[model samples]
Target: MEESTNIDQCTMEQKEPRKVTKRKFRYIGDFQVSDLECPKKRRLYWNPTQKFMSSSRRKYVTLKTKIHRLKNRINYLSTLLTELTECDRKFPVPRSIDFNKQFVTVELIQGQFVPDLMNLIIRFADSSK
Candidate 1:
């Protein structure tokens, strides 16, 4: 009976072969590197373990962030400009405020102000006319 069981097991093993399943790697986009001479090196290069952002995707994200930041800055500046205009109206300047010609005079005022900010303000004021 043991001999018969052993023979049965041998036959069963011969009848069915174990199926070896290869790992299916998913690559980003249609581009794939399969020209490598070594299979092991190819597998390592195509390994999904390492996450990488494509250059176009990185640029898109950077542009999106910049646009959002600029939009917020524009909104803030708009509100600030309106408030400043209202305040200026309420408290009239003793002297005529001329943005076009008074840049030199404004720069002479004793206060901590960025030159770039002053330039931008002057440009904005000039463009509004």
Candidate 2:
């Protein structure tokens, strides 16, 4: 019966995970957010490189949320991305960037960009490192 099926589904959903761990946001060592541009709705421009960011990636993560304040939310996203990809060395910066680096874009797809950008980077680090 339909009622029995519904009860079974509810019981299955009630099953919980055995353990949960807190995730922390990892900063991009030396990377910087050179620019942040949102020319239109549902569109974002994040530049982390010195030459300027282009829509060159095959896939991008887009997030939509309520805007309670007029502050630039995308700016934080850029900074978060920079922090996730930057190198920690103090001297000269690397001339080339390897997008496939272990901690760079490792698990970018598994992360969630919710009310903030920290979750995305956190998930990436968790899976890669």
TM-score of each: 0.31, 0.16
Q: How many residue pairs clash in model 2?
A: 3
Instruction: Output the number of the TM-score-best candidate.
Output: 1
lDDT of 1 by residue, 1-129 (tens): 999999999998898877999645555543355535677756555654344446567889999999999999999988876676689467442466788557755665745346766899999999999
Candidate 2 residue 31 C-alpha distance from true site, Å: 33
Candidate 2's residue-wise lDDT over 23-75, tens digit each? 33232333324422334311222223312323323123222223423246677
lDDT of each: 0.70, 0.49
lDDT of 2: 0.49
Q: Quote the lDDT for 111 in model 1.
A: 51
lDDT of 1 at 120: 92
